[model samples]
Target: MARCEFCGVEADFPFICSYCRRPYCVGHRLPEAHECPNIIFARPPDHVRKIFEGRLEEPARHVRPVLTSELKQLLLAWLVLGFCFSVNSLTAPQLFITTLLISLGTLGLGFIGHELAHRYVAR
Candidate 1:
């Protein structure tokens, strides 16, 4: 077992400081805790800004109007999916229509939102 240099405690699993190259216990594992002389090396590098520079620079896209065919297809899909999903809940005739409508609206919106998010992220 390695020993902590600062506290003189024996450690089964010791933490080695990247800056000072010294073994330390959990209590004094960090550079600050062990009072490392080369403390500047412990600081993380700020490379995110440099790495992602100009990556998000994209031209604005023109908003295209939805076609009537696309609207019909979406509605048809939503209706079919809603009926299939709500088939199990058909025991109560009163709640059958409500469940179907709710399923249709939620599934349609959820699918649209998911696609939008994917496009935005993949851009």
Candidate 2:
């Protein structure tokens, strides 16, 4: 059986501290409780910490547009059209030359419509 590194109590299932590489009981499992030596090295550098703290102090600036109901419908239409085009093309190859041409045309139109919808929604 393994033992807790801090309190020396027998532990059936000890939690391991990642930094110090020591097994500890639930009560002293955290790095701070055990006073882990590697805690100093584990911290981010001063500059990186300052940048993160600065961002937290600032309010959100940008208001990005989310996907509305119309955008969702347009995206769904593109997905369904693309699926149909794929199925038609695969089946059309075994059918006839005219069928193949028609499938190709449908696929092209679907691709163009999908691109146009994407551009419209983005703007």
Q: Which pairs of residues collide in candidate 1?
A: none
Top-scoring candidate (TM-score): 2
Off by over 4 Å in 2: 46-81, 85-123
Q: Where in model 1 is the C-alpha error above 4 Å?
A: 44-108, 112-123
The residue-by-residue lDDT of candidate 1 on 1-123, one tens digit each, is: 999999999999999988888899999998999999998787786644333565754445797677766567766776788898788889998799888888878886786677558768997
For each candidate, give its TM-score against the true structure: 0.40, 0.41
Looking at candidate 2, the ten consecutive residues that score lowest on lDDT are: 48-57
Q: Residue 39: error of model 2 in Å?
A: 0.9
lDDT of 2 by residue, 1-123 (tens): 789999999989999999989999998898888888988876776643234745654444786568777667766665565556556456555554555446546775676677778888998
Q: How many Å off is the CA of 16 in candidate 1?
A: 1.0
Total backbone clashes of candidate 2, pairs 3 or more residues apart or in separate chains: 0
**What is the model-wide C-alpha lDDT for candidate 1?**
0.82
